[model samples]
Target chain A: MPQTASRPMKVSYQDLFWIFFKAGMAFGGGLGILAVLEEELVTRFKVVSREDFLTYYGISRIVPSGSMTALAVAFGYRLGGFWGTIIALTAMVVPAFAITVLLTMFYQVLKNTNLLPWLEVSVLPAALALILAAAIKLGKDVFRPSAGFLLAAGAFAAVSFFKWNPALVLLAGGLLGIILFRSSQGEAK
Target chain B: MSLLSFILLIFTFNLLTFGNGPAMIPMLQADLVDHAQVLSIEQLLYAFAIARVTPGQANVYVASIGYFLFGLSGAFLATLAIQLPGYIMLPFMRTYERMRSNAWVGRFTRGLTVASVGLIFAATFSIGIKTLGEPVTWIVFIVTLLTIVLLKWNQMLGLLLASLLGILLKLLL
Candidate 1:
């Protein structure tokens, strides 16, 4: 078992490395995979509650880096310090990197074929579905009767309809969250 | 092109983009389409399509395109350039945890999440409009959505079914 820390639990280096490595291989793209990590590692392992995971997910998105990679780094650091962060991040990326390289080579040889195009067009809609499902799953916490849903919807409209820049939209939502959700107690619950 | 210049360009493009791998599409298109004598527009589009279907970072798909254009060395150079920023920055992410309770930061993130969701929605809408333009495609989209959403089917399985449907439609109709 990992040691208990005041805030984030202390995790073994081996556990941290494997957790992230498995996560990267299983989950593709940082965003979608982060959600799965939250569910499996955080919630299931009792490392954090759903609420805490949601909060972390929110922060990861707010930051300027890849959400999945950021989460892995943060989770690792929380559990095992600087070295943990390195292990986690590397583990998360390496598997995907290797797989991608192989796929790229295979694609190069088959570039002239009709089958690849057929496969792509066929899979595009499904990819969209997977992403949408991920969004729904992640957004469930904010789905209740509150300003969160409206904020999400508003942000969606701004980008989807008005073509507003994402960074700007994020800024607006953050400001609104501060004003609307702020409390002196500093408790999300 | 020199490996250094190639790496620099890939890194620069990765930094400027917002969305992961897919966001690099337009930038790659701009760089490779008119300027790079290596690839055609059709080839680039095909590369994009392949990248989307494959799991992992969209950047990897771009790397695949690079490999196609300039062989194995080009692939390594491009992938390294794109991934370098994330690898270098990973170690430092711990420092930001201290600011978890900062009101301003919290507010900022909340806003960013909202914006990201919006961007996601927009992306979904745009793709949906373009790909689901035809009635048959629309049917496939709706059916797939229902299967995944309502039936709660496995994502990969749903994708496989949809792909089969698409190929079958193409073959029969």
Candidate 2:
């Protein structure tokens, strides 16, 4: 059985905001943001044990929204109730929001200049590379040797080649998984 | 667009989105860029790149697009719209946890996870078709792929190097 902490840990809203805000400013993406949050909330502050932190993190992934923000809200609620949830989420998003607005504003100033075209067009390779990397990483995780491979390939072809709507493709995949994994023999994983 | 319309549009998108930012990209492109003509492909990709290079969630890129379409207020509204409905739904996850032990829910969850991987791939394919053509671009793309995917380098470092390579390629070749 998992051991629970002896007493409840006290966490201030300011700490939640600053930790997540710093995470927002420093990390590159969702997974990175989650990692930073774990470091601060679990390892450093001991506000939540590693197990609870991970449980909330897992919940964040299965939910519909952005995983990082969801985790922030979950963790906040865990520690400080409704207001904490609101404060943590706001803190997590604000830095990203501010930077995005600033970047776009700079883009407006630069768009008319020659440098703008050069930067935009030239960055295509980098952008595409990053996208491909993400796909490959996610693909490896979801694709098993045989059954998963077929599902992933089908989903890829359906969307990329036939240009089927992605939402439909996902539903089909889910339905197929339900059928395939329904059998006892298919429960190997 | 008016703030109400902007909020409605993004809220609709966020409500349907499952796998976060990457999954949201293709839908946003089709609706905002192709159908609505709110922004051009170049601008969309530009915002994507900015989101990539910056710290935090890639969804922030949507705010940039909102800024392009309707200035500062649009940006704020767009961010709120993309997040609010979805955030509201998070509290319901407690209920979901109880239902998760049901057979169908478990299967559906697994399916969504697997399908999300494919969705990410499809999103990349759609974007790559437009961006990758030139020989130098292919070279840069391959190098980046090998470094990041194969060797497992830090993403931020990889992006910075790729950006420099982009500049150098533009200047020289």
Candidate 3:
């Protein structure tokens, strides 16, 4: 809700390339890049307004799954054209993914290890708890003395007991929301 | 699964894998676990756990599945599959913004969020069937749930405590 207004600055593709290349020439790596990006992207080059960044960020956060990559693509498209999309995406993804791949690789290597069962045994219950907690929290927030309860219960039964495809169920929920919630708001008005 | 099917599967599911990381469980479980038998619920949960602990957002679970099934190229492909939705949906961002203030859009989003939560609840049932195999794990789960929902413990800490409790209970009993 707090808005930070950003003024966009004029910088060419050549300026962008020099910022990256000469920053490497001058400021050094890892720690210095943050400063460069803050100076250039935030204060100097100023590609996206803060509102634009936050709006895209909010969209990425609210939606499921690929928040990070989504933001990368969004920002990339804003900063450059098609090639900018590729470079920004790669820059954002590659290093962080080392962390993602490393543990999974270990999971593969440790599959037959005597320690894995112990790891699995410990992790299983924790995973279940996490899932249940999210359900309880969201349910508490979403459900009220209304059709919301019916929708929630319907969705639960469809997926859990009746074995409906969750994607279809989600589409159904959206349609119902349009019909159900819209009419209720209409009545209140 | 064929490589193409795998790509299609990830792409389709990521579109609906809304709300949060945990909301993803039932959808992933529905196809990948129950139908295809590609991975067990436990393995999937482990991957979920790893994704939670690691950097980035929820996409890592897809990456893990890809890596588990078909190695590095699979990981790359899965990453692309998951990322595709964001790209496809990008142009509509302005349309979404225009619709944001409409009463119908709010209701639509509410419907989506409520159903996503419902999916998470269903996940608790389906996953609980496989996960709560022993009394200790059940106890660990319940205590962890209480600590999270009631005592207001943070998710990461609660999970860490629950896993540690599981290991401790295993050693003791």
Candidate with maximal TM-score = 1
What are the DockQ scores of the candidates, in order?
0.37, 0.38, 0.27
| True-vs-predicted CA distance for residue A70, candidate 2, Å | 6.8
Greater TM-score among 1 and 3 belongs to 1
TM-score of chain B of 1: 0.71
The deviation in Å at residue A119 for candidate 2 is 4.1
Alpha-carbon deviation at B105 in model 3, angstroms: 3.5
Every prediction: chain A TM-score: 0.72, 0.56, 0.43
> Over 4 Å off in model 1, which ranges?
A1-109, A116-123, A183-189, B19-46, B68-70, B87-96, B102-127, B130-173
Candidate 3 accuracy as TM-score? 0.55
Q: Give one digit per residue, the lDDT tens place, for model 1 in A110-151.
A: 656654446435665555565566566656656777676788
Candidate 2 or 1, higher DockQ:
2
TM-score of each candidate? 0.73, 0.62, 0.55
lDDT of 1 by residue, B38-114 (tens): 56877777767655555555556656666766677777677666544543334333333455566666565555555
How do the residues A96-128 of candidate 2 rate in per-residue lDDT, one tens digit apiece?
A: 898888888999675544444444444556656
